[model samples]
Target: MPEHSDLGLLVLPEAVCLAEALCDLDWRRYVAMVELNFDLTQFYDHVAHRLGQPRMFARSIAWNRDGDPLRRWVMAHCGRHKQTRNQYWDRVRRHQLPLVHSGR
Candidate 1:
């Protein structure tokens, strides 16, 4: 898998897995995942819950996408520095959107 700057979290295996997973996906699939908040959010939520950490997931997305709109949305709404699983839960709390598995 290609090395992406976003997945560069020291001692975080989830980051590696996320990086590999995303890198392996086609661009359209990636966009769908983000837009639907399906597989991508699940991956992020699992990592955050397991690690008991916040911000890293958003940080990774932010670092990776830069000018990408999905990155911007993630950083703005999901990375507020105030909650756990902000990316996933924030949408859940505010939008009432539950996690939907896309058979990934």
Candidate 2:
């Protein structure tokens, strides 16, 4: 069969699984851990899709699983500075996204 070189394709689980595999490859490496930063934002950059909600579940926690356990992925220096996730959560709280809503 002839191949259509003009056609393009994209997939999610493959990219996700590949990123996760990279994490597995270098679980202890700083680059593989926190600095890798695999999330919806990065996904959009890679796969060009709009993932609306539940990024936590959508994104595999490979980074956090392998990242520095002693740190909170945020600044631990007496609240001196904030992390990117902190800023995102603050924006979410300001907008009432309710990512952690309890079943009532």
Per-candidate TM equals 0.23, 0.20
Q: What is the C-alpha RMSD of each candidate to the true structure, in Å?
A: 15.6, 15.2
Q: On residues 57-92, what C-alpha lDDT tens digit does candidate 1 reach at each position?
A: 645654575565545544454344334444555666
Writing each residue's lDDT as its tens digit, candidate 2 over 14-104 gives 5575455334433323222233244223432222222333555334332345544222322232143236546755776679864676898
Which one wins on TM-score? 1
Superposed by TM-score, candidate 1 places the C-alpha of residue 98 at a distance from the truth, in angstroms, of 25
What residue runs in model 1 are displaced by over 4 Å at the alpha carbon? 1-15, 24-40, 46-104
Clashing pairs in 2: none
Q: Which TM-score value belongs to model 2?
A: 0.20
State how far residue 6 of model 2 sits from its true place (Å): 39
